[model samples]
Target: MGIAGVLEDARPAAAMVVVEFIFSALQIFIKLALDDGMDVRVLVAYRLMFGAAFLCPVAFLIERKKRPPLTVKVVTGLFLCGLFGITINQNLIVLAIKLTNSTTIVTALSNLTPQSTFIVAILSRMETLKLKKPSGRAKLTGTLVGLGGAMLLTFYKGPEMKFLRNLGHTGLSHAQGSHQQLRPPPAEGSRILGSFLAITSCFSYAIWLTIQAKVGQVYPCHYSIAAMVCLFGAVQSTLLALCLHRDTDHWRLGLNIRLYSSAYAGIVASGSAFPLMSWCLRKKGPLYVAMFGPLIIVFVAVMSSIVLDENLHIGIVLGAVLIVAGLYMVLWGKAREEDEQEADEPKAKAVGQDEELGKETTAVNGES
Candidate 1:
């Protein structure tokens, strides 16, 4: 490969790193909007709608000529992907952050997404346990460790991280006197509930990841599919938002954090981020993309510490270690499995070639 080829190969890796930063910023933005007292439902609705508006035109221009027809089955699948993937996933995420009052929790839990996806793949018969193989064993161990980390994060917060807490209070001085102070941070029960919501949100995303393959198979137009999902999710989220909150004032976005966060979430996070991810997925495969998962957690932890002045706990420290360790183990196993398969291919081909040559010689001898 020449310079161009090398650059092209490196592009996805760089893009994924940027994507993780975008995602980390997204959580902070959403949390900021929530702190500003914008209703979560309203924010989600606006976000999906904004994403749709940004993406629909691009999809139409790029894929309109070559895109597949939107048949009933395809539309239905897209709708469900929107419902479970975008609508449910986005809403639950916002709610979880609101309850936890910490972006770190959400980002930490997100590491579970890959594990959930792996489990879903195995149960759906797309993959084997391969428990007998070292690669498989690594993957299994990784999943268990990751789950243990999540459980630890949820159940035990450990001692208060006083230094970090002090940093948060200092960082948040300007953000004080908002509705945030009026409503006390979540108690134990609320924290547990928030953790549950975050876990459920991760599963919802995993389900989307798995089913998107079927949608992609039929549509084959990634841009168009994303546009449709955003459009559908917008509609679903708006209806739900209206049902939950009747105040028109809450829907209005002034020159404030609420508007800024919504715009960023919709335009940058949903609109731009999705396409970049699609590009990376096509270029580098899911494993390569997944290997970057740990980056999001790191980004979020740092951002939260600096931006939200959020404190870290012993549980968070310990849980992050386990989850990140698990993610690498799983990715490593997958890499090895792929490498072994690739190595076997040439050997198998050589064996077949030798058999063919021997058969040709035998035929010639018989003729003589």
Candidate 2:
């Protein structure tokens, strides 16, 4: 490949890394905003609504030519993607953050994405196992390591709870009013359970990505698909939020920093990120994008410690290292496999041509 080709190929990976990093940082900001008494359901609903409002026009303008016809199958796929990917995933994630520490949730959830994606891909017939292939073996090993790291992050509390006792004034004050007798201080066991729920949300998201890959193959328009999904998610989330909140005043919009934070998450994180992710996945494939999940975890851990006044524990650092190492091993094996396949293409073509020529010669001989 020429220098230009190399640069072109590098851009998508770079873009994905940047996007994921931004998303990681954005989580800290979201947590801060949520700390200001924003309801999780309300936050999720507004994010979906605002994201859809922002993305629809862009999709229509950019993907006007390649937009798929509005069929029942396409609509149903979009709705399902919206429900699981945006509505349930976002709500559960915000709930996890509210219920547990950001460091634990981020680390545990980050490692689960690849394992979930792998399992769903295999079950959906998107990927196969070939134990003889190095790529296959490496992928399987990497996935197991990733899963083990997730289990450790979610289940093991280590010898000490570094951040458990350090609940700041804000968290303490918030804890006092809501179920004071029933809810106690943040416990290691509860944090572990919250981490598990976050991981489950990651698995749900992985299913969404695998399904989106198939949808991309069929529809071929990333922006349009994203727009439709966001639209459906907004509708579903709004209804759910309404059902959860009885007082109409609780749903009213407020003009404050929280509102601005919601807009930022909606426009940049949900609206822009979702479509960008889909485009990257379509062009580069799922493994390429999924490989950056651990990178996001690291960024989130650092930013959360700094911005949210959370502690950086030794366990988090070790878990992050294991997760990133495992992710890169998987991605590296995949790259090598792709390179080998490319190199073998010409040999396979030549062999097929020779076999066809031999058959033609034999036929001529028999006829003569």
Candidate 3:
């Protein structure tokens, strides 16, 4: 392949890496916000609202001419998407971090996203698994390895990984202090609860990724669907928050980490990241997008140790190692699958597909 062809192939991968990095940073911010006593419900409500505000206008202007009609199926799918992706998924994530008193733990569990997605896809007949094929075996092995790592991460808390904690605390904790807990350590029950919540969140996220693919298949307007997701999530979560809290005190926006983190979550993380991920999902499929989950753990591990005074225990370090190993195995399998699929296709059709892919950047700016 030529330089342009290579760049085209690399673009989405690079975007996902950047998005995951942003996610790692956002985990730190949200942990800080939650530490400062921001309620998870309130945080989720405001985040979706902020995301809706940022994406609605952009989606409208960009997809104005070619936007598809909002069919009932698409609308219903979007509502569920918002619920799974934003409301339940995000709240569970924030609460998991708070309850566990450790961002790294929650992050480590996210490695299960791709594994869950793969299993769900197979059950739903969206994908097929052939044990005879090397690629299929690699994919299965990767999922099994990742699941084992997640189990280890959950059940075992070995020695603290002091090396990670000593990495970049000076910068992450400049506003606070060196190597300090964001709050008092939680009870054992809360940690277990948090681990369960984190696992649920990953499954919810996997379901969202699957639904998003289906939604995109029906309604190709990326930004519009993303905006709808945020808007619906905002409305749903806000109502839920109101039902629980009744008082408006928690809804008040203040000029603090809560507001900053919420805005960043909504605008940058959800608003910006969603459309990019949707594009990648359309291009490389859900498993490709989900594979990036393992990368987030490493980033969160370092950042959590520095910013949230989270200790990377032996379980975490070893689990992360296995997870990363599994990630690459899955990625390699996917790559081989794609290469074989292309080889099976007519050369002219492959060239045509590449041409369309070459238009990816322009399409991102134009369609989405």
Candidate 4:
């Protein structure tokens, strides 16, 4: 490939790394805000609102010509996407952070996306199950292994790594390193409840991915679709927050950590991350996009330990390794299948050309 071609591919990969780093930082920020007593619902509402506002004008400016008229079906799909992708996922994530810690949440999220999405695709018939093929078997096994790893991470909290035991905070906190519990009163039940919520959120996110594929096929405008999803997500989350949080105290956002967290989550994670990921998805296939998720786990593990004072547990490390291993197995299998298909294309074309030549010769013989 030419230098220009190499640069073109390099850009998206670089962008994805930056996106993961931003997202990793966002997790810590969200934890900080919650630790500062920001209600999860209220936090979600503000994040969605800010994200929607950020994206609306950009979508209007760039995709106005390409944007299609909104049909009821498209609108409904967008609504569902918001409900599952933004509202449920983010809410559960915050709650999980409240219950457990950011490192655990990131570990659960490490390599589950592809496995969950693949399972959903098979059930929905969006992806075929070719059991005879090695790719199909590898995907199946990998999905199981990934799920098992997540389960291990949730159920098993081994002793902290000895080397990382005495590490100090990375000074990401603003309040003189005071780490207070900002979550609900239930502390003992956190591990069990948090694990369930985290796993459920993964499933909900997978469903959103399946629906997004269908929506993309119909609308085909990435920015416009993202804007609509954010708009609807803001409305849904706000309503939910109002119903649950009647106390205006929880919604108060002064010039504190709460305000900063909401701003970063909105502008950086939601608003900026979505469009950037969408562009990467378009440029590099879903597998390429999925390959970058493990990077979040690495970033989160190191950052969480330093910033949030979270322990680096042996179980988390072991489970993360298994999850990533299974992820690569599935990706390698799919890549091999794609390569085989590409290799056969030339032979198929050659056969077609030969048939055409024989027909032409027969026609000439008849003419003679």
lDDT of every model, 2 decimals: 0.87, 0.74, 0.83, 0.81
Task: Tell me each candidate's TM-score.
Answer: 0.88, 0.82, 0.83, 0.87
Q: Please say which candidate is ahead in TM-score: 1 or 3.
A: 1
User: Per-residue lDDT for 1-368 in model 4, tens only?
Assistant: 99999998799999899999998888888887877778989999999888898998988999988888989999999999999998998888788877875544555553577787788888888888777888788888888888888877777778878554456444653243555334334353686678668777877899998888899899998888888998988999999999999887988888998888888888888788887888898888877987887898888877776776666778888878878877877887688779768988999999999999999999999999
Q: Model 3 scores what on Cα lDDT?
A: 0.83
Let me know the TM-score candidate 2 reaches against the reference structure: 0.82
**After best superposition, candidate 2 residue 319: deviation in angstroms?**
1.8
Tell me the tens digit of each residue's lDDT in model 3 across 1-368.
99999999999899899889999888888988887778889988988889999999999999999998888999999999999988899889889988988888888887777777778889889999978877889889988897788777777788876986676466657556632533467887888789889988988988898998889898988889889988999999999888888777777778988999999988888877777887888898866886777778778887787776566789877877887777677777787888777776898798888999889968898986
> Which residue ranges in model 1 land beyond 4 Å of their true spot?
1-10, 162-173, 177-183, 343-368
Worst 10 contiguous positions by lDDT, candidate 1? 171-180
Q: What's the candidate order when arranged by decreasing lDDT?
A: 1, 3, 4, 2
**Considering TM-score, which of the candidate structures 1 and 2 is the better prediction for this target?**
1
Taking the tens digit of each residue's C-alpha lDDT, what string does model 1 give over 213-257?
Answer: 888987899999999998999999999999988888989988988
Task: Tell me the spans in candidate 3 whose CA falls farther than 4 Å from its real position.
Answer: 1-14, 167-182, 275-293, 339-368
User: What C-alpha lDDT, on a 0 to 100 scale, does residue 188 get in candidate 1?
Assistant: 84
Q: Residues 227-341, candidate 2: write the lDDT tens digits.
A: 8898998999989999988686666777875777678778988776776677787788867787667677767765554455565555655665666666776787677779878
Winner by TM-score? 1
Return the candidate ranking by TM-score, descending.
Answer: 1, 4, 3, 2
